[model samples]
Target: FEEINDELIYKKDFDIDTIKYAILSKLNPKYLGLSPEVIILEL
Candidate 1:
């Protein structure tokens, strides 16, 4: 989470969409142990 935020902030021109995609990409793999289907549904 902090890493994703740092990546977004570090890239001076990052927008919300880019930040969201980056965070989701990073989280999805780590969160795979949980119910990804439910998570996606909620999101």
Candidate 2:
């Protein structure tokens, strides 16, 4: 995240893989897992 001219923006350098892994963990309650339903909203 970055603040520019009083507005916040998602940094292009942000690691997308990290976001995917986070979503995967949330969907997998039993243990570490991966799913095809992972959705990343880039802004």
Best by lDDT: 2
Q: In model 2, which regions exceed 4 Å deviation? A: 1-12, 29-37
Candidate 1 lDDT by residue in tens digits, 1-43: 2367457434456566665566677674855655443222223
Q: Give lDDT per model, in order.
A: 0.52, 0.69
Q: Give the TM-score comparing model 1 with the true structure, all chains together.
A: 0.34
TM-score of structure candidate 2: 0.40
lDDT (C-alpha) at residue 33 in model 1: 53
Evaluated at residue 19, the lDDT of candidate 1 is: 57
Q: What TM-score goes with each of the models?
A: 0.34, 0.40
The residue pairs in collision within model 1 are none
lDDT of 2 by residue, 1-43 (tens): 8799999998667577887777776774666444465667658
Residue 19 CA error for candidate 1 (Å)? 0.7
**Backbone clashes per model, in order?**
0, 0
Regions of model 1 farther than 4 Å from truth: 1-9, 29-43
